[model samples]
Target chain A: MESKNDELLEISNLETLDNYLSNMDNSKSNSYISKIPEVCKEYPCCLGIDEAGRGPVLGPMVYGISFCPVNEGSLLVELNCEDSKVLNEKKRDDIFVDICKHSNKIGWAVEVISPNKICNSMLGRSKYSLNQVSMDSAIGLIKAAINGGVKIEHIFVDTVGPADKYQAYLKNLFPKYKITVENKADSKYPIVSAASICAKVVRDHALQTWKCKEGHEYTFKEFGSGYPADPVTKKFLADNVDVVFGFPQLVRFSWSTASNILKDEAYHVEWEDIENEAPSPISNSTITSFFKMTNQKSEKPLNTFFSDRYLSRKVDL
Target chain B: MAIHIQSGKNDIQTNPKFSNNIHSMPFKIHADCDAQISKYFLQTPIEKEILSASFRGHPLLGKEIQIPAGYRGVVLHETMKPATEKEDRKFYVIHTFDKFKYWNWEKAPSKNDPLVQAMDWIDIAEALHSPVVEE
Candidate 1:
């Protein structure tokens, strides 16, 4: 994933996303892991895992894994890669560059789960919840790192769901490795911090260049970090909702924010009503029945038709 | 007169609370009629109703009616008997809103015209299904 940054620099380039998303089959889950090589020769290694952009209503959620020799803790200290959320974008980029420089000593992997994929999984008929998807992504990164030949002896993860259950799940997955899953593990462990930086940097890049595959030319600046709470994002959503079609492909329609916008602002035709079946039958009008009548004995047509059928027009209570 | 019914929820099927039971909402229908034309409005904006009705009477009547972007609902057409047997029969086309869909579109009308035109009925149906459909 480290070499992948050069392509990311070209924000509009579809190839950057392609490189990051290469080799994904799409038959199983929406996420796939990309691995970077390990630099250290140590017998035992510690792996730290963390994620970024999980809460945002926009953009992809990324899970990252970082590993290094147990004794190479000083290298992470030199990079000052801790609490990526607090670091400015420039600082995070700088720390990421440093990690890339020490690529031989530090190995990392990341799983980028796109916004469209997130919406699909969350809104799927099977109801693949976001938490389950996130768990799968975190575990995927760890598995990718190990399968790529990194000697992972100890694992530390920043938690989103219940920590004990998550930790136990990981422990059962790999009984040979020591696992710790807790909140704030990114700030507490250097490897987790590095992983957090990796995830955050990758997600930032992905969002910055996000082009709605649906052909919408939207940048992250237009959406303001893809967070529902961001005023600019809220305004963007407000300004672009389509009455008939709803929103562009960029939106997660399943999210309450998007759904509410559709309910409140976009058109809402009931496509499926058992009572009102497809090719909605024409309303049965009294005028039509009158027109159908042949050879009326009355000299004049019914002038009080509207008044006579007032009760018929009233909807049944 | 046009009346707006403010419902806090969307599709009745999507939300368990909003059942299939139809509530008698506040409804007002305004009518406009002339020698060659008749227009009926049910909560649809006066301007749009008049516009579509006017278009229906134009020489380009058979061509797709120029519905303003962001508006969608039923444009019902029914044949009516003329005053005399020799007189040409009349085609009555009434433009009415599906209260919820029309008002919702009124609140937000930012869709691109060509994009909506390109979308088929299937796209609209899938979108209305409360799921994200790929283009």
Candidate 2:
């Protein structure tokens, strides 16, 4: 336990956290886990899972899980891991540090799903929704904890979308373990609050130290809390938009706020697949064809080969 | 109007080298703008020969094509505009390329692509303009 605390203590510092995040590729999701407590492997543990930054249009959505012995649920409350929404940034960071300080009693992990990844998944051809991404992350964390030798016998998760559906799904996956899923589980359950705090602290730091893959540097104040309603975030989106590329990787391009801005500010771009999906206006009616033929000129039509490829003689360079 | 190319200062190299860095997108942008391709357009190989990349959050598949033999590609830049309609514009050779990679949105690049098919014209044009041969 002491050695685990020493290892975590080094990473608890903000500088180390920044280094850890900056070293990863900003375009993909990443996971980080603390060393499993020896006690957790020996005894049946109750694990809590929660997420943060899910609503933000900027920055990464983070899923965090915290686990301790089934009997030591009060230890989380003692560490001041209360409702993360009620806690400020400083309070969350302090709680996270305290959680790390008591590493022997608690262990946690986080999955940072990058904004670029969110946009890519949602806008992909198959169209993976945000809810699916969240569910996958939650499932991944639980699997990772179990794989890392944690004897998890009870699981609690803060709900995404409908609570009943999520609970049923998780129960199906882990039938041996008792599972509870509820709205506001972070506030109702001390273990979940600890998980929320872990997720929140990591997400806040991730936004603060975000290095744009486009080689642009920006402060948190510039993008604000990444909510679409934040004027600072809106201003940042409006100001930094490229006429061709739209926003950088920090902003979720699939979000309505970003897409709306792009529709107005950036040059119009049409993808072949998207364009082909639209309903064609031409009609097959004989009357309409007769009327169309009456207005046609007596000239030769271009070949279909050139038309299909959109090839044309260039009039100018 | 005739355009005068300043070949003395910016001579076209006989042995021109080309970089493999190239991309073709399936979307049309209605404006001319500069892009930071090297910084944002990172690519990875998804299969043995197929490459994958993304453009503005959309996935793209790419393949490289070599220029046909006995031919070279040149890039021309219009250095200066003519002061009058009758005056000739000045032009220069900026760069040359022998091969480039083309990309498609979520689709594999193939010979059926318009650009790839355009290369077939080189051989057809040679055949059309060839001198008559005596039997």
Candidate 3:
């Protein structure tokens, strides 16, 4: 009953975001993708894995894998599982179950890299760590599959991060399998399209779940699809970020978002307070402390969605 | 002679992962390896060429590639929605970015980020061409 009420509120309250975007115009650039031939030699059982939302402002990076026997993958091909971007969400949602049904195997591994941790990396070479998380999850998924005894001769992944990084990651991770990580592997391969569907659906659910549990009270607010240049999302940040301790547990402080939130100020002041520079990982107790903070502040008791053991690390010395 | 080392058009699959254990550089698999498989795998070479070239010369390549914005463009059959020429064909074969790069009518993204290190890549393999259907 509560879930039903929350969904209704989200739909009704965020009604201003009614503008429809053509999925085609919004598709990943072609330069990021390519095609591969059906290596029938790797048949009997072949697996393809990919990820989505690695660059988004909100939500966990979701990794998905789709598998089918090369001999009996007629169901997958018949569904026209070309690419997830080519199909509407309704169509994707509808066929998702069917694809997994025909899949020789399917799996989703999601890791929510928090905004604070992301904040540290943002100061470094890149702003997003979802790519790193994606690489990790992809490696974990393949390792899981190999352990599960499914024979995958060829592995396809939509490319992520620097091309060089992808190459290094794959070589070091799966030296035995012919893992091809190109952009638009979805457009070029049905297997990847299937992987995209699994990733997309799962991540969308993760976002909606976070939204439902948090409600409209505070700790986090509207990110307006979590894309940069979203006016409403930007406004939400300006409206809420004045508190001294800083942004919500979910807000990625490493994004231009944190700096932009402090745009009114010179930014150096904000940095001094939030600069969490330490070679050591934040103990899980810090995560718990954050949860307690939110729960204490909110009108309702907050549920901890992630780990709690992030404290007791002797204060980052 | 080295068994007259059979080359080109070999229908076979040898592990590229462990090439040192198998064939040497420019190695030959059974006549039906990637060469033959690649050709048939591609439904239309013209379309694949267009996509390959566009990807190689990406429009979003900020300062890395200096392409002029006014350059002409073309599209591939798959990238476009309709098989016929009437639909929205946004696939531009050649285009420039920030009024700089001329997209040399040829080259692939792989070439720009050349594989000099020869490390493993995240290679996603899709069947390049759809299976031929009789009209």
Question: What are the candidates' interface root-mean-square deviations?
Answer: 17.3, 3.2, 24.9
Off by over 4 Å in 1: A1-42, A269-317, B1-135
For residues B1-135, write the lDDT of model 3, one tens digit per residue.
011122233423333332211211111122222222221111112343323111100111111231223321221123335566444434322211222121221233234332211111211112334465789
Positional deviation of residue A135's Cα in model 3 after best superposition, in angstroms: 1.8
DockQ of predicted model 3: 0.01
Q: Which ten contiguous residues of candidate 3 chain A have the minimum total lDDT?
A: A16-25
- How do these models rank on TM-score, best leading? 2, 1, 3
lDDT of 1 by residue, A17-129 (tens): 44444333221134433334444334578899898988776667888888898888888988897889889998988887777667668877777776656765664334678
> Model-by-model lDDT, in order?
0.60, 0.83, 0.45
TM-score of chain A of each: 0.75, 0.85, 0.61
Runs in model 3 deviating more than 4 A are A1-44, A103-117, A120-130, A162-165, A211-222, A265-317, B1-135
Q: How many residue pairs clash in each candidate?
A: 2, 0, 46
Error of 3 at B23 (Å): 64
lDDT of 3 by residue, A169-245 (tens): 78777787776777778888787887787667655544544532222343223555455566766766676553332
Error of 2 at A241 (Å): 1.6
The alpha-carbon deviation from the true structure for residue B3 of candidate 2, after best TM-score superposition, in angstroms, is: 15
What DockQ does each prediction reach against the true complex?
0.03, 0.42, 0.01
| Per-residue error (Å), model 2, residue A284 | 11
Q: lDDT tens digits, residues B26-105, model 1?
A: 11212222211111111213343321111100101011222244544333343444555455433332433322221111
